[model samples]
Every structure is written in structure tokens, then in C-alpha cells.
Target chain A: MKVIETINLSKIFEGVVPVHAVNQVNLSIEDNEFTAIVGPSGSGKTTLLNMIGGLDRPTSGTIKVNQIALNELSENELINFRLKHIGFVFQSYNLIPVLSAKENAEFVMLLQNIPAKDRIARVEALLKEVGLEDKMNNRPSQLSGGQQQRVAVARALASKPDFVLADEPTANLDSKSAENLLDIMHRLNKEEGITFVFSTHDQRVIDRARRVITLEDGKIISDVIQHEN
Target chain B: MIFKVAWRNIWRHKVRSTVVFIAIALGLWAGLFTSAFTHGMMNQKIDSVIKMEMSHFQIHKPGFREELQVKLLMNDGENIVQAIQEEKEVIGVSGRIVTMAMLGSANKNGSVRLNGINPDDESIVTGINEKLVEGEYFRGVERNPILISRKIAEKYKVKIKSKVVLTMQDMEGNIVAGAFKVVGLFDTQNGMYDELNVFVRRDDMARLLGVGNSLHEIAVLLGRHDMAESMADKYQHVYPKLEVLPWMDLSTGMRMMIEMMDTYTFIIVGIILVALLFSIVNTMLMAVLERVKEIGMLMSIGMSKTRVFMMIVVETICLTFLGAPLGILLSYGSISYFGTHGINLGDAAYADMGFSNVIYPSLEYMDYLVVSMMVIIMAVLAAIYPAIKALRLKPVEAIRKI
Candidate 1:
């Protein structure tokens, strides 16, 4: 089943001169799909991802996630929707600095009001799966760039989200750390069947994606699929 | 969890948090200390007035206070005094013959209110005997011996045993003059009262005024000052023909001063807290601004705006709680120490104000509780604007903030 579908999604930035950041973009991602939206600067890859995650409202379009129209929800309702269904990983590794890796992983489920026992069990398992079990007590500042990003992934998966939206998640990492992060995410995607839609400029990330959609000037230029190397 | 996060968040900037904590602590300490000191001064002044002049309550014939006419004297003054003395609450009572007269010395002359008293009974009521600075208190002196303040002695260039003349009209409307020797010079710490009043034997005063056994005022001292009003009310019922006045009625200025003291303290502390309020708001706003990206991340991870707001408030409250109790305890310790040891203003400064040089600072525990609560409330109020500012951030945009 399609987990996310966007029909004619458009966003316009009004300024001294109008800028069409995303124009009439139609996209669909299936469950457990490892999809990459690849583009150069000004190609609106982040804007498209923001729209799909309900982080930004579309200027004119309908984004349906699991049959719920994202544009029809109120601001507060959209926040709840994102909290329950769509997790996010930002380029900057935006982990709460004061929280340790384990606490950060448990944060989303805590907000969901899940039972403390289940929250702790799920967070422990997710941290172990992401190879961060031993580093669970270290705060983000104590962790390296790779470790912090891994904690972010564990946090995103803690809520059992339907899909995870990642915007340039590997852009700030060293090459090896980037490759390791991609391996962990790919493994989680394969083993847990957790779908992921990422916006990236990194060629290494595109190389690993199962499907790639290339955009230029806010329009899709190509859509292609690749088998395992 | 929000509390845990908030508590950890404040310590992230150790220097900044410590600075705010110390500022609040010092502000509260200063406010409490100032209040205690002011209360001490006012209390001393009030106590002096009640002890040396008004006592707790006084009784007089109707219209006597309005005009000091000898005809408006209590007809049964001894009976009223006996009744007051028999009351369980009454500690002391004094009957006085008061008359306006001109006091004349060899070098100076002034108009003064002459008070006639039984020296022994007056001593119990006003402690006048304890205030004698020279010679004896109307003891072993010749006929018509008198007590004069040191201010009056210095003004008249007279000393103990110097003879002075008093002239006044008798009750029969006849003008009379009498000569008296100054048996004692007293300093009441009240320059105005010292200059305006002279004490003479009630027998001598009555003989000169030709009104035998007539008393214009009956002063009553109570064991507990808090019972003054009720005692006054009871006295009025027992002696309906006479006017019974509590210290508050006899001295309106003192009453007004006491009433305004609490209001003044509140205004003063409120102004201090307002200054603190601005400082706290500025600091919390800076904290929120510095953590925009992290705040956005939390919101994006499903933290509600209300939760974010409460986190800021909790952080502020923790900061306040950290400082307020320390400040209050510090103030309490300091006030208690000084209350026992006393803070001495120079004698000359307090001389004219009817106050002693040494003032013992005091505060009720309720005042500490009130001031601490005010500081906490101010802190919460101060946090609101910053918390609302944190809530206004759009997660998408704030996550992009550098």
C-alpha cells in the first residue's frame, strides 16, 4: 500500500518577485520503500520533503498519508499527525543537547503517553539496533557526529512512525560516518520494513537508494529504480 | 520529564544561571532587610509615644481634649482611676491635673502645658522616674518641687534646684502665680515634648489653680497593648458620662503611620520585584532565543506548545526557588542578629524625633513568607512573556535557525 501520496503539490514563495519553490509535483512512495529525492541547490527537494512531513503547508495540493489528507488538518492537528505518523531527521543532527541518547530516543513515545515499561523496552531495543546501546547514557555533545545522527534515527523510529522524512541527513557527516549512517538506515529499512523518504545532494546517498527521483528547478526530471549492488 | 529537562537546561549556561540566581537572592535580601529596618524604626517611635505620652488608653470629661479648659475636668476622676486599676488587663493608672500655663525662668519664658501627677503613680505609668538625668524625682525637695526636661533647662539656662515661676488662671477665673524649684531634669528623647511640657506636684498644681482634688485626665496602661481598644470600649460602657480614648484615638498621627507602614513596604518591595521582573524576563528570553533550534527540534518531536511553555516556566520557578529561600533565610538571620544587638543611629539624629538612638530591627515570620511568595509570583509572571515567545516559533523555520 502507498504510505504517502502527493498530487500536484505546489509551494510559492512570494517576494519582490514570486518564486515557485515547488510546482505541480506528483509523487508516491510505497510502504517500506527507500526513496531519495535528489536535486542540486534551488531544486526544492527540502520543500517537497517538508510538505510530505506536514512541517510546511503546501500552497496548493493534497498530501495524503495513509489516506488522511494532510492539508485538511489544522495546525495543531498536523502536529499530532506528524508526531504519530511522520518522524524527521534534519541535516544538523538536531538532538536535544541536555538529553542523553537513551532519553532522546524515549522522548517521542513519552509524548505519545505510552506506558513507561514499553517506552523503555522499545528505546533500548532501537538503540541496540542502531548500535548505540553502549552510548545511551552519553549526551549529544559527548557523542561524535555519527553517533548523534544514529541517536536521531533511533528517536525517529521510537514512535513507530509510518514513514521517516530525512532532509540532507548525511550532508554534515564525514564520508565514513555518512556511509555508516546509510548502512544503519538501510539495514533498518530492510529488516524492520520502515519506509524512508530523504532529500539529499550527496551522491553516496543516491547510490544506495532503491528508487531515485531527480528534480531540477522544482520539476521532476527523472524517476529510476535500482537493484541491490 | 519536562522538569528534568528544564532543570538540566538552566545549568547548561552555568555562569548565566548563577548570575541570575545571585541577583534574585540579593534583591530579596535587600527588600526584606529594608522592610525589617523600617518596621523597627516605626515600632520604636510608636512604642515611645505610647509609653511616654499616651499610655494605652486615657479617659477625660467630654470636650476636654477639644479644648484644655479646666472646667471640662472629670468630676469623679478618682473613681474612674480606681475602676481602671481594678481591671485584670490594667497594669497601671495615673490621674493628672493638666493646665496650660506660662513657665518663667530668670533668663527665658515660654508657654507650656503643666501636668500635675502623683509622682509615684506617674512613675509606674510613664516611667518618668527612670528618665531623670539630674537630682531626684520630686523627693527630699522643698514645697512646689517640679520636673523639667533637659532641653528646657538648657533653653532657660537653669539647673537642678533653680527656682522657676508658673502663672495660670484658677478654676474660679482668678489669675495666680507660684514659685517652684526644679528638682529633676529629664531627657525624654523628644525635643518638642521636652520644650512644651513641665511636671509639678498635683497638690501644688491644684493649690495654685484653687481646684482641690480636680483631675483633667486619667491614663490607663494595660499589660497587653493589643487589648487597648477593647479595654477602651469597656471603659466607655462603664463610665458612659466620660470619654474613653485608645492610643489610636488620642494619637492619630501614630495610628496613620502604623497603618501606612505595610502599604509602604509592599510598594517598596513591589518596585524591587518589578526591577527583578525585567531582569528575569531578559535572561529567560535570551535562554529561549539561544535554544531556538533545540526548541524547534523538541516541538518537531511532538512536544506540545503548552509543554514548551511549561518547561520555560518550570525553569524560571526552579531558578527562583533556588535563590528566594536563601535570601529569606539570610535576611532572617541578619534581622535577628541586629534585632538583638540593635542598630544605633546617632543620638543627635533621633533626639528631636522622640526615638532612642538604638533601634532593634524586627520582622514577623509572616513577612518572610509574604516576601518569598511575592518573589516566586514575580518570577512566574516574568517567565510568561519569554515562554510565549518560545511558543511562537515555527518548527520548520526554527529548526533552520543557526
Candidate 2:
């Protein structure tokens, strides 16, 4: 079943002359599918990804995730839904600088008001899974780029979200770190059945995704499934 | 966990956090010092009034306090004392005689009020014996001895054992003339008390006034300091004709003026606090703006906007908590240092202020706590606008901030 479906999604930055960042688009992503949205700079891949993640509103359209319409939720309900159902990994490896690797992973769970014992155990297990158990106590500045990105991945998975959004997650990483991160993400997707959607221009990432969706000038050009379920 | 994270965040940006901490600390310190000094000054004034003049409570000839002349005593002075003695809260009660007299010395002269009191009873209200510098206090009611103030002594150059003549109208409307030996000089320090007041024994006053064993005013002391008001209320009901004036009423002008000074001090402090509050608000707002992308990232990771708001507020509270106490501590040290060796507003400046030899800025611990709490609260309040701004920020726009 489609875990996320976008119908005629569009976003226009209103001004003296409105700039159409994301034009009319329709796409569907299946559960547990590793999908990538690839485009050049200002090609609206990030904008399209934002709309799907419920991080933004479409000027007109419907985005359904797990069969619930994203556009229909109030500001408050959207926040609650996101905390429980959606996770994001960004290019900046945005692990809070002050928090340790483990703490960065555990933050979303804290917001969920999860009990401390469960939170601690989950964070520990995730850090180990990310191969950051030894560096769990290290803060963002103390960690290498790849290590920080791994923590970010661990954080994204900590909430047990049905879907994860990665926006240029490998942009700041070297080839080796990027490869290592993708392998870990792929493993998590296969083993845990967590869905992954990434917005990226990295060919290595595009070559690896089970599905690829291409966007240009704010509209999807193609939707191709390259790998079998 | 939020508090722990917030706390660590403060230390992460060492220099910036330190600056903020110092600002908060300074705000709190200044607030504490000002409040403490004001409170201390008030306490000092009240103590002086209670110590030197009004003995907690006083009974007077129904109208004698307003009209300054010795008059008929309370109809039942002994009975009143007996009644007061029955109340556990009554510390002590005394009979007092008050009359106006012309005071003269070889070099200077002034008109002064003479208070006739019992040596033993006066001791119950205030430390009169300690204030006596030159000579002994009156031995008994018949000694015809007087204790004049140090200022009066300085003007008269009258030594202990010197005889001085005083003239005043007695209660019966007769002008009584008498000579009394100056046994001691007291320096009460208060302007009104020091310059023109003398003390004589209650018996001699009764003799001079021709009131046989009757009292002009009954002064009662409370067992506890704070009970003066309630005690006075009881005294009022007990003796309708008698005026029950607490020490607060005795120095009304001084209290009012002190309160006025405190109000002015608060206004000045409040202005500074508001400025500090704005500085804090501006800093937080700037921080929120700079971290918009990060905030969006957090929200996208399934963290709510409410969580974002809480995190910002936690950071603010952490910063302020870190700073406020240090400021209060510094203020305490400064106030203490100045309190002992007063600020010395310069002798000329001190004189200009119409105060004594020194201007002491003193405070108590509770003053520090209260002020620190207030500054912290204001600092927290300052973060509200920024926190709400963070909550209102759309995740997409914030993440894509140019």
C-alpha cells in the first residue's frame, strides 16, 4: 500500500510576483520503499520533499501519509503527528551541538515523554546499531562528519517513525562516510521495514535507491521503480 | 533531560554565555543591593524610633500628645498597669510625665521637652542605661537628678554633678521652678532626641506637678516586636479616653520620607531592570533567528513546536539561573564591604545629603533573595516573546531561511 501519496501538490512564494517553487505534482511512495527525489539546485526537490514530510503547506493539493491527509491537520495536530510518525535527516548533520551522540538520538523520545529507562535503552541500542556506541558521549563538534551523520540517522530512527525524510543527508559527508551511511540506512530499511525517502543530487544515492523520482522546475518528470519489492 | 541539555548549552558557548550570565548576575546584584539597602535603612529608622523615643506603646492625658502640655493623668494609672500586666504579651508598662522647658547654657540655648520617667520602668522599654555617658541615672523618684542629652551637654559645657535650673508649667497649671543636678548625658543620635530633651525621675515630676501618685501617660512594651499594632488595638479598647500610639506613629514624618525615598529608588531600579529585560529579549530573539534551520530540523525529526518553545525557554532559564546568583553574591559582598566601611559619599556629599558622618549601604540576605528572584522572573518573562516567535515559525520557511 502507498504510505505517502501526493496529488497536484504546489507551493508558490507569494510576493510582488509569486515564485512557483513547487509546481503541480502527483506521486505515490509505497511502504518500506527506499525512494529518492533528485534535481539540480532550485529544481524544487527540497520543496517537494518538505510538502510530503508535513514540514510545509501546499498552495493547493493533497498529501496523504499512512492514509491521513497532511493538508487537513491543524498546526497543533500536525506537530503531534510529526513527532509520532515522521523523522528527518538533513545535509548539515543537524545533531544539536550541545548534546552527546546518545542524547541527540534520545531527544525525540523525550518529547514523546517516554519513560527514562526505555529511552536510555533505545538510545543505547541505536547508537550501537549506528556503530557509535564507543562515541556515544561525544558532542557534535567532537565527532567527525560521518559520525555526526550516523547520530542524525540514529535520531531519525529513535521515534520508530513509519517514514524518514533525508534532504541531501550525504552532502556534507566524504565518499566513504556517505557510503557507510547509505549502507546503514539500507540495512535499517530492510531489517526494520522503516520507509526511507531522500532528496538528493548525489548519484551514489540515486543509484542505490529502490525507487527514483525526478523533479525539474518544481514538477516531477518521471517516477521509475528500479528494484523489485 | 531538557534542563540538563539547557545547562550544557549555556557552557558550550563559553564567552557568549558568560556575557549573558554576567549581565543577569549584574542585574540581580544591583537589584538585591538596592532592595537590601532600602530595607536596612527602614529597619534602622524604626529601631532608632523605638529605642530613643516611643517605648512601643504610650498612654497619655487624653489630649496631651497633640497639645504639648502636662495634663491630668489617666484616671486609673495603677489600674491600667494592673490590667496590662494580666496580658501575657505586655512586656512592660511605665508612667511618664512630659512638659516643655527652656534649656540654657553659657554658650548656646534652646527650648526642650523634659520627660519624667521611672528609672526601673524606662529600662524595660529601651536601653537607657547604655546611652547615659556622663553621669549616673536618677537613683529614685526623689533625687531631683536629670539626664540631659549629649548635644545639650555640649552646648552647656555642663559637667556631671553640675546644678541646672529648669522652669516649666506643672499639670495643675502652676509654673514650677526647680534646680536639679545633671547626673548623666545621653546621645540618642536622632536629631530631635539629641538636641533638646532631658529626663528626670517620675517622683520628682509628680512632686513638681502636684499630681500625687497619679501618672500622666502609661507606656506599655510588647513581649514581641511585631505585636505592637495588635497590642495597641487592645489598649485602645481597654482605655477609650487613652491614646494608644505605637512607635510607628511617633516618627510619622521620618517613616513617610523614608518610604518616599524607597519609592524613588524602586523607580530607578525598575528602569534599569526593564533595560536589562530588553537586552535579554533581544539576545534570545537573535538566537532564535540564527538557529531557525536547526529548529526546523528538530521539528522535522518528530519534535513538536511546543518542544522547540520549551527548549528555548529552558535555555533562557538556565542562562539566567547561572547568572542571577553570582550577581546577587557580588552584590552581597559589595554591600557588606560598603556597609562596614561606609561608601563615604565624601564628607561634603554626606553633608549635602543631610545625613550623619557616613552613608552606609547595608542589606539583609532576604533582600538579596527577593531581588534575585525578581530579576530572574523578569529575565524569564523576557524570553516569552522569543519563545512564542519560535513556536510560530513555519518549519519549511525556517529550514530554508536565506
lDDT of each: 0.89, 0.80
Task: Tell how far residue A147 is off in model 1, in angstroms.
Answer: 1.5
Residues A90-138 of candidate 2 have per-residue lDDT tens digits of 8888778888898899998988899999999999999999899999999
**How well docked is model 2, in DockQ terms?**
0.61
* Runs with alpha carbons beyond 4 Å of true place in candidate 1: none
Instruction: Kindly list the per-residue Cα lDDT of model 1 for residues B147-215, writing each as its tens digit.
Output: 999989999999988999999888877889999999999988776677788899999998888778778
Count of clashing residue pairs in every prediction = 0, 2
Query: Over 4 Å off in model 2, which ranges?
Result: A113-133, A186-194, A225-229, B22-36, B71-91, B139-144, B170-177, B202-214, B254-283, B323-380
Which pairs clash in the backbone of model 1? none
Q: Give the lDDT of residue B169 in candidate 2.
A: 84
**Interface RMSD, prediction 2:** 1.5
How big is the positional error of residue B3 in model 1, measured in Å on the Cα after superposition? 1.1
What TM-score is obtained by chain A of candidate 1?
0.98
